[model samples]
Target: MSVHAIFLSMLCILLGLAKPSSSATDTFVFGGCSQIKYAPGSPYEYNVNSILSSLVNSASSTSYNNFKISLPGSTKADIVYGLYQCRGDLSNSDCRDCVAHAVSRLGVVCPGSSGGALQFDGCFIKYDNMTFFGVQDKGVVMKKCGPSIGFDSDGMTSRDSLLGYLTAGGQYFRVGGSGNVQGVAQCVQDLSMSQCQDCLAEATLQLKNQCGSAAWGDMFLGKCYARYSSRGDHSRDHDSHDDNDNDDEMQKTLAILIGLIAGVALVIVFLSCLAKLCDRKGFFHISSKEDPHSLKAEIQEDRYIEARERK
Candidate 1:
């Protein structure tokens, strides 16, 4: 293959091998598109793209941000409002990656919709023509309850205590463990503390009432979520641990592949540079019998003779 083609092929392979920040975090929890569709190439479509781009860009710096987009002279219907919020525990880089994934998935899941919402394990994103920011929405968007453990009193007590602790915290994100139960709760940053408390209260209540004696449960409200896992009592925890292990192994394998690809790419670059250098110096057709140093000397002597002849 030509040197340029080889280089391009190597580059494509490198890019294809590159992995995202965290597959577990990028796992799709839920997504929905609006029933209302915007005309393709319409002004509203432009605003939607702009707002989604803003959301992805802003995620690198902050865990939560809201954006409003409206061009001058555009009507209110053409405006777009959007926000993205990453899980509190994620690093800025991870948050950026998660939000980017969510944004890309939004286009696939909610193509041309005037409104959409997507929730991933690590981030949440939503956009619409109407205003929804800072508005309290306690409506349940998702609920999952693990297999029932037939009412272990101690496990139930631990789960209840953890949920209560999650609600008592004033921060937007809370995590706690009680005995064998691990719990986490978070509300959108725009909510006031009281609003967050109310949201979590509703979420935990749902978990308690709907998932009674369950080994694990999740309650996702419009603006908040609460989840708890009872260790050693559920398969979900074990499955998650196995998934993490697999992810680690896959990452290590990818790292080795990247290293190998990068090495090959460097070698190709070096050879290309050397070939260019040789071609520029007129060294492409040196006789096999000639020493390279002697060839260089002969070329210089020929150049000198040519200069003398010209004079």
Candidate 2:
């Protein structure tokens, strides 16, 4: 194998998607005909069912829809059928825009192809000559941006630390990860946990191949994103909701004591870590802790693995 291939394979091991068993196909794709257009004849040229058209453009930041084409006079399919899905986390508006771009661009790039899917950072859309719901497909195209920087020689250990943290569902974590390499993983919604892990694993490997040794990098796909950055964030503010809820609040500090304690390092460290996590990708906040109705993206599969196992 080439260097890129070797690096990619190694990365896959790190992310936990190296080799997964393919299970028998047991997937279902539902609803797709409302927003589409079609013909009115007995022999359809794959007309979009009214049901499908209505549903295709209906993803409310967390769903998928179907699209189709038909002959001018036929009622039966003579041409094509397909489905689309935006990332489960995107707002409906974002999903709609992404689909419009993806579909229009797909025509320019691969005209007449009956089946394919396009994924943007926030959405994914797939169509095929044959039905494609619930079928496991690694054939979707994926891309990654180069890492922004490099790792310390100590970087490899941190990388492994993150990998272990994710794969073992945080079992191998050391809580005092005060300053460690930053890493994140995500997978499509429909996948089983194992399948999601497998997808993450593949994406991790792809990153290694594409951005070897770079400091900041990401594996981007139609369905998910896995990324890492080298900037050690040790001082982040955490008490956003209640300014008085500081961990240091218990310390009896006369105004003078507070002034005297201004240079303390622990306060800085706690603040930094807290600030970095709340707003970043890969991290998930519990619903009750944060506003449940707030419009945040869906937490990825890997993030849920630990919570799921704990239950």
Candidate 3:
């Protein structure tokens, strides 16, 4: 098969493996596409398209809670770096769905952009044209808090204990509850111990300073995220056989059905484009007068322009 055909086949397999789905609690948090734009026919654009499939595949195929992949561009000038991290409480299936949804959503939101990041309640995904691995980004990307319900001593204590446990432990993440208060703290796997500590400290400070006295709060930083809640039994029981869990499963089933339909549609589109290219260049006519190299170059230009137009 041709390179394009291989890419399409790989995409189909990855989409199937991802089994894109959503649950009652799974919701889009926030994300931003980079401002840097690539020209219609630039190598950077090609690299982005080529590597996106691999990134999504890597993210969904892993049983581990976190996944990261980096692919060099066709040339040395550009590369694609990507990573996905699921919350500590999520199941592997749920994690795959979140990551798949994130990959698709971020691609649409930032079409042809050089970089982007998307965060959901259960997972986070990010990609860029440069090497961002092992780097600690302390910047605050987002912060949100529930309505103030005044101060609760138990909540504050639990939150402190959560952070304290994370600081003392060697793990990159911690989740637990004390009394009626529940909290979670996590740092990306790429961070060093010291870097993770610094990020958690900054995140904790932001959670306190920005979300004062709120019943529930979440702070997303460059390399870490912290959350706490004091609003009625916030602890999650992943193994519970309850009505809410059933509803969540139903939602996931529907989401998976929709994703499969979308995947089929994408395959149709890709095949159509391939057919047109083949016909336009007389691919079956080896003795045709047209130069194969020129036709391929034209096809590349066409794809780039189409991508830009869609954006």
Candidate 4:
């Protein structure tokens, strides 16, 4: 397959988790375009779409981007409900986008009158035809730690080595926030405090399972993180590095790669390009006035004007 096709296929199949319909009361309805399925004995099989449509519409009406609705159907029980929270630092746009994506996945991952969850890095959405919204269910949580975090480095100090994950209450956090790393927690704002806590705890377990002994990964689906070390926080580290020296490093590496791909000398090409750019106007004017016969002079006054315009 072409690289593009392989990339797309991998993305489509990535969410491998499946909670098969083992429950006598459960029905799994995986979503596909315009496809519909019904629980074996559901008295209101036809109205399932109506129930989902109304709930989604209502959610859109409110600012509840991460909202979900369930229908118990009159013969069964009250529809279960759930919504999740993206990382709190995410803006309104991100929250809305994440929720919408999660909702779409829900139809595919969990269809029909059964219970299921659609998990993502930003959030998780779930529902059953049962009342799960207000209740805190610990049974749903999953956890895994870096069971194989062991590694050895020649120059790195013991303190800088990759370490296994630890819980929030452990000695890992005993230092009480001495670093740039900040602990983050998020939940559907509608969740009760206890419910939020339960959700976060559950998410921690799931992260442990997925990441194994890796030094870092998502703490859980859209809930919270309770490990240690901000230095290993790639998100923050990457963002800060973009400001200056790191940007140059990236540009240099990119220039080299492009040169190789295009069968040209990358460094020489970049330097030549830069030199031409500088020689544009007052590119290398040196003041012979201040220093006797200095090779460099003040930049041509017009070049400053051009630089300002570029900015």
Candidate 5:
């Protein structure tokens, strides 16, 4: 093949390999749609689409953004308010991808709803006809507690300390570890600092009061969430064993994927080096005979020397 053809082929292969992995960040946590539905071709639907597009576009530049959409002739009731917030640590590209995915998912999960909300592990998106911006909503949306292993005073103390540290932070997102316990807390950026603190405080309090003695716990309120996990706690249940097995399988899958990607990258590099060598030697035309001075013959000789040197 020509050098240009080979380069194009490699480019295609690299592009295929460039597809991002399905991270835990994109995992669906919870979502809900309003009971009210909009007309099929109404102004409300148009505004919803516009606001969702704004969210997807803005996510590429910022981790948190809110948009309000109202057409020139649209009424107050037709206005759409929407917002998306990615996890603080995610890169802009990841944030953009996550928001796009969430937008697509919201359509499928809550089609034509006047208002809807979706929360993934990495981000949150919400839109509505009525205003919810800068609102303080402490209502519990979701709560999960891992299987209890009875009461361990030390473990509970560590969890409490870690949670306290998370609540004390003034940032929109906070993470900390204490002993064997690790915890994270975050609030939507629309809230004031004090409101964010109050929301996290409420979430952590729920985790403590409701998830007592559990190895892990999650409490998600309307505008904030808190979660914690303690190491070295194993549940004595068949389900927990199954969960552990699933985790192990996931790890194995990730390892195999990484290995394959590395192998492909090495192949691309080798091919690129070979292309450069061929260009330098003006060996565009393939030679059928095993001429000693040919590119193929030289490559083989170099490999032979390398193998011998490795011994």
Candidate 6:
């Protein structure tokens, strides 16, 4: 076979074998511990763990994907309040998975802080010794900005449009945009509609102040999240909540399919060339009795006469 044929066959085989298996990915976005620390193995630590366990259990088993629970201790000081909220775009299973990861990460990152907030791309988790449910925490736990891009009106305008849609009858959670500016904003479920809007607005203002020229930015506050990207789909407009997720998944599936098809096509071409080579080498010689008048028979007769004359 030609060098090209052999190389193509090997490449195809490698591609076929290299298909990636579907697996869970970590969704950790950010996390923080309160300045207050609890003694290791103290009753307070035990209480926190107990509260985390309940939150995790409820998150895993619930269909709503938003839940808050409080565990009262023997003394009021041991009481722990916790809650988890999944991004509206996530499916039930995805929400659960994100919450589970967030909860586990909180233990490692915050340890015994009386109050800790764990945020993921798909969910948010927080716990405190003091009650925080229904109360908006104006504290800014995390703020991030994408690298600076040339600033223009589209960036701010698109972000504001997206936020407006979210606050005004966008179910308090929304994803939308146009051109190169797309964004989403969401609030914890315990908050009222107005409270959700206020929290998102506050977060958006913070992002504007900190990352006005950024290609993308996000602000994770006590009870809400607001973000926009000037360069990515987060900035691009979408028809629905899951549109972005579905688009990503579809793109991935298409890439794998294209790879598989290209690999298979290369393999078929290589095999065809190999078969032609084998035929020329007489590995599949025609039977004389089956086709006595065939081209191979005439060539063999000429070869026999030439050999006799040489003898």
Q: Whose lDDT is greatest here?
A: 1
Model 3, residue 288: C-alpha shift (Å): 64
Model 6: what TM-score?
Answer: 0.62
Model 2: lDDT of residue 93 = 70
* TM-score of predicted structure 2: 0.45
- TM-score, candidate number 5: 0.71
Model 5: weakest 10-residue lDDT segment is 231-240
Candidate 3 lDDT tens digits, 1-311: 66457556765765575553447335777889889887777777766665556555655555233333334435665666777777776776777777777778887888878888888777777778777878999899988887787777867777677656655556677876766667778888778888888898898888888988777777889889877776433332322236467757766875676577668767877988888899799886554788999989988999999999999
* Tens-digit per-residue lDDT, 1-311, candidate 5: 75456655755665565554576567788999999999998888999999999999999999999989998778888999999999888899989999999999999999989999999988999999988889999999999888897989988898999888899898999878888888778899999999999999999999989999988988999999988887532111223567568767766765676567667767878898998899789986564575757776878999999999999
Q: How does residue 185 of candidate 3 score in lDDT?
A: 80
lDDT, model 5, position 163 = 88
**What does candidate 3 score on TM?**
0.63
Per-model lDDT: 0.87, 0.48, 0.72, 0.44, 0.86, 0.71
lDDT of 1 by residue, 1-311 (tens): 87567766866765666555456678778888899999998889989999999998999899999999997667887999999999889899999999999999899999989999999988999999999988999998998988899968888888889999999999899888999899788999888899999999999999999999988898899999998888732213635866778768876887777677778878888998998899889988666798989888998999999999999
Taking the tens digit of each residue's C-alpha lDDT, what string does model 6 give over 1-311?
A: 86556656766665565454322324456787898998886677877777777666666555233333334444677677778877777676776777777777887898668889887777778887787778977678788887786767776677666656655653657877766677888888888888887887788888878987777788888888887876555522222236557757766776676577667777878888998999999997775567656776889999999999999
lDDT of 4 by residue, 95-210 (tens): 45655666666766555635556544444455545555555444433332332345534212222222222233322121222334323334555556666656656655554456
RMSD of each: 10.1, 28.7, 20.7, 19.9, 12.8, 10.0
Output candidate 4 Cα RMSD.
19.9
Which residues of candidate 6, in runs, are more than 4 Å off?
Answer: 1-25, 39-43, 61-73, 154-156, 235-311
| Model 6, residue 234: C-alpha shift (Å) | 2.9
Spell out the clash pairs found in candidate 3. none
Off by over 4 Å in 4: 1-37, 40-84, 144-182, 188-190, 198-214, 217-311
Worst 10 residues of 1 by lDDT: 232-241
Residue 142 miss distance in model 6 (angstroms): 1.9
Can you write out model 2's per-residue Cα lDDT over 159-215, one digit (the tens) per residue?
A: 556644544342211111213566655555545566656656666667666766665
lDDT of 2 at 227: 59
